[model samples]
Target chain A: MHEMSLCENILQTLQQQANAQQYSKVKTIWLEIGELAGVEADALRFSFDSVMQDSIADQARLEIIDIAGQAYCSHCAKNVPIQQRYDACPECGHFPLQIVAGDQMRIKQLEVE
Target chain B: MCGICGCGEGHTHSHEEDHSHDSLDHDHHNPIDGHQHAAQHTHAQGLSPARMVQIEQDILAKNNAYADENRRYLSQRGILALNLVSSPGSGKTSLLTETIKRLKEELSIAVIEGDQQTTRDAERIRATGVPALQINTGKGCHLDAHRVGHAFEHLALSDHSLLFIENVGNLVCPSAFDLGEAHKVVILSVTEGEDKPIKYPDMFHAADLMILNKTDLLPYLDFNSAECIAYAKRVNPKIKVLSLSAKTGEGMDNWLKWLKAELELQRIDYA
Candidate 1:
C-alpha cells in the first residue's frame, strides 16, 4: 500500500525533528490527515510500526487527527462539508465543488523526549 | 521568536529548505537531565513530560523538494514532461511506443518506464528508436520525485524535448506522487468499468487530462462514453478528456495536438 511510503515520509520528518529538537526518542506523533487527502488511516497505522522499525521514533504512538473535508460551493457561494471529491454542494446540490480545505496531509506536532 | 530554535508561528519554508539541527539550549533546563533520562522522569500523574513540538509541515515535503527540482530542470531546458498513469493492461506502454513512433522524428522524445520489476516497457520504447529508461520500483507502488529526478539525469534529455514518464500500472498511488511533470495524463481503457472515475476519485481529481484509451473496443463493450465523461467531470470540472486508441491510431491526431500545444505553451513560458 502507498501508506507504507507515507509512513516512511513520516519517519523522515520525525528524524529531522528529533535532530532539530535535540530529542533522542519520540513518544508520540500527531498527524493531521484530512478526510479527502486519500490516505487510509488504518493502512497508515498498519505500516507505521514496521516503517518506524530501528528509527529514532521506534514504538512511537501515532495519533492521527482526522480533519473534516470541506469544499467551496460555487452555486451556493458557501463553504460546505463534503465527504468525497465529487460530492455536490450540501445546500444547492451543485456538482463539482471547488475544494477550499480539508485535503491536507501534514505533521502537526510531536511529543518527544 | 524563541531564542532556542528560530521556529515561530509565522515561519514559512519551501520544500527544499534544509532544516539543520537547531541545538536546543537545554543547559538552562538541567542539560543532560532534560534531554535524556526522560523515560524514568514522570509527572505527578506518572505521565511522561513529553514536550510538544509544533511542526506544521506537509508530509510530502521531501518528495515535493525533488519534484520542484525536476520542474525547474525541465522548465529551464523547455522540456515538456508528462506523467502517464493508468491501471495494468491499460496499454500505457503501447501508447508510449505509438506516440514515440509518431513524434520522435518531428520532436526529441524519451521515456521513463516504471514497474515493480520489469525492463520490458523500457525495451519496447527503445525499440522505437527513442531513448527510454526503466525505473524498477522494486515493490514500491509509485515513482517519487526523487527517483524521477535521478532518472532524468541519466536520460540526458535534449532541450525542448518531450519526456514521458509512464508510471507503474496502478491508479491509486501514482496520483499522490508528483514526479515534476508539467501535467499528469491519466489513461483509462474502455475495457475497464466506466465508473472508474468514481471508483478512483483521487486519480481522476489529480489528473489534468483523462485519456479514454482503447476506444476501438467500445463497439464490443458496454462502456458508456458519455457516462464516463460525466463521472470524470463530476470529480474534476476542469479536466480535459480525449478518447483515443494507441493500437489503431484512432484519434491519435488529437493526442498529438495536445502534446504540441503543451510544448508550445512551455516554449512561450520559457520565452
Candidate 2:
C-alpha cells in the first residue's frame, strides 16, 4: 500500500525536525489528510505504528485530522463541500468546478519534549 | 494533593507550570473497581486525548516537497512526462512499444518502466532503440516522485522531449501519488469491461487521458466503447478518450497524431 510509503515520508520528516530541534522524544504527531488526497487514515496509522517503532517517532501518537474536500463552483461563484470531484455544485448545478482545498497532505505541527 | 505535579513520590518535580495535563475524566470503565487500570492501559495504548488535538498536520508534506522539486526539474527541462497507469496484463507495455515505434523517428523519446520485479518492460522499450530505464519497485505498489527523480538521473532528457513513466501495474495505489507527470494516462483494455472506469473512478478522475486499448478484441468481448467513454467523461469531463488497438495498428494514427501535436505544442511553449 502507498500508506506505507507515506508513513516512511512522515517518519523522515519527523526525524529531520527532531534532529534539528534536538528533541529527545516526540509525544505526538499531527497530520492533516485531505479527503481527495487518496490516503486512508486507518491504513496510514497502522503503517505509521509499524514503521515508526525504531525511529524518533516511536511511541508517538498519530493524530489525523481529516479535512473535507472543498470546491469553488465556477458557475455559482460559491464555495461548496465536495464529496466527489465530478459532483455538481449544490447551489448552481455546475459541471466543472475548481478544487480549492482538501486535496492536500501536510504536517501541521509536532508535539515534542 | 499538589495539582502542579502529578506527584507520585514525595519530591516535587515541578518545572514548567505552563505544561499541565487537562483532566477530562475520560474514564470509560468503573472508576471504583480495579478495572480502571485496564481502561487506563487502553487509553495510554490507544490515542491519548491530549495528543489528539495538538497534532493537525499532513503526513505527506515531505513527499509533496520532493514532488514539487521533480515538477520543477521536468518543467526546466521542458519535458512532457506522462504517467501511464493500469492493471497488470493490461497491454501497457505493448501500447508503449507501439507508441515508441510510431513516434521514435519524429521525437526524442525516453521511457521509465516501473514494475515490482524484472526489467522486462525496460527491455521492451530498449528494443525500440530509445533510452529506457527500469525501476523495480521491490514490493512497492506505486512509483513516487522520489523514485522518478532517481530514474530521471539516468535518462538524457533535453528540451522538448517526451518522457513516459509506465507506473506499476496497479489502478488504486498509483492513482494516489503524482510522479511529476505533465499528464496521467489511464489505459483500460477491452477485456476488462466497460465498468472498469466506474469501478476505478479515482484513476479515471485523476487521468488526463483515457486510452481504451485492444479494440480488436472488442468483437469477442462484451465491451461497449461508447459506454466506456461516457463513464470516463462522467468522472472527468476534461479527459480525452481514445480507442485504439496496439496490436493491429488500428486507430493508432490518431494516437500518434495526438502525441505529435502535444510535442509541437510543448516545443513552442519551451521556445
CAPRI accuracy category, model 2: incorrect
Which number leads on TM-score?
Answer: 1
The DockQ of each candidate is: 0.45, 0.22
lDDT of 2 by residue, B1-271 (tens): 2121122235321321135211111112111121111112223455643332233345655556657777777777677888999999889999999999888887889998888887778888999999888777777898877667656755758778899999999988888787778889999999998888767778988999889999999889878889988888877879998889999999999988887776666554443
Best by lDDT: 1
Model 1 residue runs over 4 Å out of place are B1-49
Worst window of 10 by summed lDDT in candidate 2 chain B: B22-31
| Highest-DockQ candidate | 1
On the 0 to 100 scale, the lDDT of residue B169 in model 2 is: 94
Instruction: Give the per-residue Cα lDDT of candidate 1 at B14.
Output: 30
Q: Give the clashing pairs for model 1.
A: none
For residues B1-271, what per-residue lDDT tens digits would candidate 1 score against the true structure? 2222223235332321253111111112111222332243344576656688899999988778778878988998899999999999999999888888889889999888888885788888889998888777777898888767756756779999999998999989999999889999999999999999999999999999999999999999999999999999999998999999999999999999999999988886633
